[model samples]
Target: MPKQVVPEGARRRRRPTRQGTVLSEELIVRTALRLLREHGGAGLTARRLGLALGADASTLYRYFTGMDDLTRAIGDELMGRALDGWTATGEWRADLRALGLAVHSSYLAHPQAAVLTASRVTGRPREIAVDETILGILRGTGLPDGTAVLIYHAFIDQSLAFAALDAGALALTDEARTGDEGVWATTYARLPAASHPHIAATARLLTDRMPHSAYPAVLEMLLEHTAAQVAGLNRSQH
Candidate 1:
């Protein structure tokens, strides 16, 4: 028997799912984020995503090549949100601080997704845009190319590294997370003065400071050092 031919357009066309949710790359990434938030990293398989979208698992491949590709898209979506309404205010220090905080907070807001993607190099549009913005801000400091690149690398990696650390703690189960937090108050705060003089003396301070993310303080220090470097360069040019 002769085979019947299907038109190219018909083959490419996809109908809306039972829930009337249209599947696009953006939609998939957004839905994937919500699933990650609700179920954590391990629960974000294609089958689950399909169920959440009210569609067949195979339907996702129509948008993304595979799960890895989709994961990268999710990472890019986070970056896009980080920069969504952010604009540079022409002050390099203030701008860098704002950008760093924005990126860090964005990751912390999705701790589960950050666990999966914090270390990934998406090389997608949003990630590339972030890199470009960072380098541009660094260059605007009038620093040499090597220095600008060095600071840019350090700044970005530091932001992600801290975000990943904080997110990991945030991603823990409720009881585990609470137990971890309790250590500062129960164990560290109760350290014996004779055995550990410094820690014992400063236990109260440690307990107060340890629970918060250190990204902001460290970011301020980096910005301050960068500003000093810019000043030295300016002095040398005179």
Candidate 2:
């Protein structure tokens, strides 16, 4: 058989097509997460996301109202992950620790989103679930109703602020990152031996302590206060 002739014009006009999974809202959010992880929060935009997904930027609106809405959804997803399998066992300290660490670790996973979502209290279902869980644990601790709510707010706000600061510091530019952290190191190194004897003496213990190590101590202190309040109520009952 004779070979068929190929047209040079047709060959020149042909372009290869990309083959892969189609882009969807969940897939887009997941891709945004990767971008956030790699480039930080400012990097998350419809254009960038579309480029990542190989789709038109407008397609994202089909799933989300806007970037703000999309970010909220991402936050909700994070909260859900953090609350996975959480249960109250009527042990206040253990329950509080679990919730605090879960929220902290969740935001740590996506530092950029943590900054965006941390300040905004979305009364959305997952967030409400978290609130309910904490309230349930605090109530189960045998504290009065008002006392339980107060402790819940105090603990939650404390945890959220610390987590946000930790995430934000990590996301800073190299110059900013070095400067912010280096200040603490520099501050102590220059502390006078005579004028600031106390600061000079304990500077080693203060400087060498990691945020992780110190945070739990602070949390324990807060829990201690909560425990004291609960203990007072118990004593009064007796």
Candidate 3:
């Protein structure tokens, strides 16, 4: 089939069929996301996507070159959602914290999709904007150019790494998720105090807290260390 060339940033034109269902790029991407959520990562094939969208599997290629292209679009959409409605305050540390939390929360919102796309570098609009925003924030810290770049690399990579890892845990099958959650309460809590004194001493707290994702705490630690480094730089420059 010939490629259907669509203009950049143009709303996907929906083609109405005798079946009465309209198909567009946005519709395809949204359907793919839904399939991923409902059926897990293996659920997002072209056949399943077509079945969900009420179109032929071949119809997807008109919008995306193939499944890989489609996945990248999905990744970009996640990035778009992460930065949506986000405005940076002039305070660099506060702004970075808000941005980090926004990214983490957005990924957790669609854990299955996040597992698939969180590590991808989609050079699309929203992804590009996010990269630029991170660099801009780091530069605003008054660090030397080399230091700002290094911190930018660490900050962005650390956020994405944690987001992907946490989302992966969340994207597990229901049975797997239940089993994993139970490990802290069922297994660890049952350990003998004589054999594991430290664990037994704090078993209750561990069981309560271990079920929660550690992304927020980890992100705060990263920001705090970065802030300390920035402070050191300021002191050295004076």
Best-performing candidate as measured by TM-score:
1
Ranking according to TM-score, highest score first = 1, 3, 2
Question: lDDT tens string, model 2, 1-238?
Answer: 3233234333221332132556455676688888888877888898988778766677576566678877877777777778995665666799898788888778878888788777777666788888888898888878889988898898788777877888887778879977866655689756998999987887776666642324567788888898899889889999
Error of 2 at 14 (Å): 27
The parts of candidate 1 lying over 4 Å away from their true place are 1-12
- C-alpha RMSD of candidate 2: 11.2
Error of 2 at 146 (Å): 1.9
Please provide, for model 1 over 84-147, each residue's C-alpha lDDT reduced to its tens digit, 9 standing for 90 to 100: 8578899999899999999999999999999898899999999999999999999988999999
At residue 95, give the lDDT of candidate 2.
82
Give the C-alpha lDDT of model 1. 0.88
RMSD per model, one decimal: 4.5, 11.2, 2.8
Pairwise TM-score winner, candidates 1 and 2: 1
lDDT of 3: 0.83
Per-candidate TM equals: 0.93, 0.82, 0.87
Report the C-alpha lDDT of model 3 over 64-95, residue by residue, as the tens digit.
87887889999888778879957878888888
Q: What TM-score, to 2 decimals, does candidate 1 have?
A: 0.93
List of clashing residue pairs for candidate 1: none
